[model samples]
Target: MDDTSNQEAYDRIARIAQEVFDMPVVLITFMDGHRQWFKSHLGTDRRENTPDQSFCRVPIATGKTTVVENALGDDRFCGLNDVVDGPGLRFYAGAPLMTHDGFAVGTLCLFDIKQRSFAPEQVRMLEDLAALVMIQVKSDRDIGRVDPLTRLPNRIQFLLSLQDMVRADPGRTCWIVLVDVIDNRNANDVIGALGIDFYNEQVRHAATILKRHLPGNTVYHVGGAYLAFMLDGAQDTPHALIEQLDTDLREPLVTSRGIPSALNPCFGIRSAGLMEMSSPDVLRTVLSAAREARLSERLFATYNSDHDDAQKRMYSLLSDLPEALRSQKQLYLVYQPRIDVASRRCIAAEALLRWNHPIWGPVSPAELFPLVDKTGLIHEVTDWVMRNVLRQIAAWKAAGIDLTVSFNISSKNLFEDDLVSRLSEVLDATGVDPKRLEIEVVEDMNLDNSHIAFSRLSAIRDLGITVAIDDFGSGYSNLAYLLSLPATTLKIDRSLVAQALTDHNAAVTVPTVIKLGHDLGYHMVAEGVELPETFEQLRQWGCDEVQGYLFGRPMEPKAFESWLAASNKALLASA
Candidate 1:
């Protein structure tokens, strides 16, 4: 009713009724809760009035044509404000705009200041007009209900239909299944490489496959690249349908340009009694499950409340992180001392990010970084960490403390075009030596783009800044590729260190990696060296540096300065 087209249609109908009935005022009104909202008023300037002040309410309430020859003579309407006040309407006639379900949602009515008799033929004509109004209303609604591209019912219609089903049989059990045809990253890649037309073709192809597989089921384009449908829990199982759909989707979809693209669909399913959940809640639950499927690399996943709650918390944390970065107290860095194996002296430290969320208490980097890595905000977060770390280094340098600091950067950040320039600007601004700071690039980066990564790292290294291959021996660590990288150090992953003494393969692999890193003319650092035996083993392997709780856990800047002083004093005393 708020749509301009709907308003225009109602206005045209109201004008026709006023001219045909020879009435002074004509209105198309709908009863909305406690108020009567006028969709169209030909003679009156008022937009809405209370139901008690409306003549249309009578026909809507009765679900039939209502006629009052004289409002002043009728006990039912004589005391009404519109009747007793100025412009005193005496003749009133209304025909209920009843839906197909036999409920009157509104009314088309005529009013006159002068008392007049309404003939039976004139009453019939008003009812006919009311029917026409209903038809137009439904036509507009149906148009809104469909997806323009696929010609299928969209999320709006799906929610409406689901609500209707729940109302009809609250106890009925059903399964809501959602399929993500392709993830956002892949969808963007396809659209960027090919074009929107090809992407639309892919969506249409997926819709066609879904319709063919499900046959009688109605598949809805609930979201971008997402298709959803519901199944009766008693009559059908989504497993078989999901399997068939998955198999079909695996086959490449050929576009008009004959380029073949795979859908790579994942499914999320939630089964519950309709009475147990609202329509929107059910859809949201299934969507969370779909995201879980994609994250876990599964073909399908069932809804889990625990995972859903955790995901919600993650999103809340992500939302709060930008503000937290700006605040002085919420976000801070802690330094874990890196000890040189030969001198057993504190030489450098790694700057680790920490967040003390006001609401969530403390957020771990493990939990926060994975989510941040998936977004563009990773760049902002990386820049924040770099700037803070550089400032801390400047403070330490000014205080006559000779210490180097390193910070981790995401794989995405390593390939950033302006990474070198950004670092150079921050370094110059802080008056910190480039050699005093190190950039840690994780080894698990996509090697397929190794050439770009190599060039970016080389550019950074040309600035006289040290680059270290972090989390070595974990992820895709190609020795040949590792040799080609412009990195000066290799930090062994904690997993291998944690399992080295206990696992046979790790025991052999640990020393081999340390020796290989040294042979490549790279400094070797072992992380997670908790046990004294582990530290001794790495020291014997000629590892250049070691960082773990065995030395000191990550500490604030002041605490790190104190710890470094105490360690230096101890070294002098021991000497």
Candidate 2:
């Protein structure tokens, strides 16, 4: 298992057998300790499996998974009639290529003479692409066991399906229910941008309601938001199949965003017995009794085998976040400064996202921005944060820092109908000033899909940029859908500026949403100004700007160029 982890698990099983069987042909041989060695091939036999007639010895004598429909009535390939009657070979399917311990040794199996009949979702996408090539050959042999997101089966497939159900019921008592999902990234940022295809269709609808209400031989998703099941030792059948998959993945899926979001799970039940331990210590004591039933549902966190393994090192740092955004690695950016309350200076900055975690330190945009918008990797992390915030506003206008930076952009980056011609080709490839670049967005759109969020904020205000609407009154029909948005700016929401001076109806709903965003000409800013009476009551309510941490905290381009040169000497010593 080492020749660079068997050539990186034979190049991820010859690239998922030529992308899940669109198969021009793929091979992975390896019976090698004796003869068969081809390790990866596609489309045609450049010949190599010989030592004693080996078409993988019928997937090691059908220990399970071998189909070759019509290799001419398959009489052990009727004496290999010149390789299946003169190159005819006829439709085929084969599975038994297992290794992570229960070794069949080789055969991902597929070849077609074109007779056809493949869909049961293409044989469960070729048995989940041969269970992702036996989870990259048990993670290149270190065997963390599995669950690098739905490759399914983990906590070592619930301790090898609880040691084959305690070596086939040595006594009885089994139950080990565990469930997950809650605060699923702030209910997927309040249901906008189709909350990651409704959080992967509520984790494949909670693994199809625990494989249709659990009489399970073993079910396990086991990564971040856990899902384990073993139950079928009967007796009131594991609390009625964990109360029917906690009422079918907490129900509410209807979308076009009226905000119904469901799935809030956190279960933990344990029972074991057949002489107390081992089955990975009773699946780590039903994952420490589902981490004490997730501390009474305070948003999941349970594990045992003594905690340290921070969810298996956050599933090996969410599995190399796709080679850290395809090798741009731990991507970077951090600005924040925003001020301007009638020129208190640091005129604009927000860009903020930071990961730099080559080893887990700074990750937040609330933890890799919904895992980069649930793995679509937010359009290549918003095209590397809009080509590095237009090359840091063309490096803050060659050190001038005239200011206007902004950035946030994610109502799914305005459904990309060439997002304003790819933001006018990254502001004509970084000359930068699309009026100093502001963008923001995030009130989490789908305000009843307000005409596809006002045609994606009118094609991002026709790319001149400066859009805004971020968190404005934390959405749910944002002020009866603010004039169908062409958004010039209207930030307003750090939960209505930390409840405007102790909430006198949030200081009359923050100056009536800043006089209805200044009678709709719209420019109201007031974000989270910590206090100097909330930046002089958002500059006596006219509110044109005011960012947070009381105007400073998200620094770092050399501490925001030395906090914009000590905020231009405290704005010329307070004028």
Please give, for residues 1-575, the per-residue lDDT of candidate 2 as tens digits.
Answer: 43345565666666776786676566665565666665566677654666455555776566466666566666776456434564565666766667655777666667666655676677666666677766666666435555655656677666666676678767777556667655444554645766465566566656766777655355787665667776544566465556666777788765444546677787766555676534455555555556556555543343354443544555566776667766665767888787778868777888876777777866666655765575566777788778888888898789777778887766766666776777788788778768788787776644445676677667667767778777777645365556767778878778878889987987898888889888988888887789898899878878877888976888768888897898798879889
- Which candidate wins on lDDT? 1
RMSD in Å for all candidates? 4.3, 21.1
lDDT of 1 by residue, 260-317 (tens): 7788899999887866445477777888999889989999999998998897899899
**Consecutive 10-residue window with the lowest summed lDDT within model 1:** 1-10
C-alpha positional error of residue 222 in candidate 2 after TM-score superposition, expressed in Å: 4.8
Shift in Å, residue 86, candidate 1: 2.6
Give Cα-based local distance difference scores for all models.
0.87, 0.68
TM-scores, all models, native as reference: 0.81, 0.29
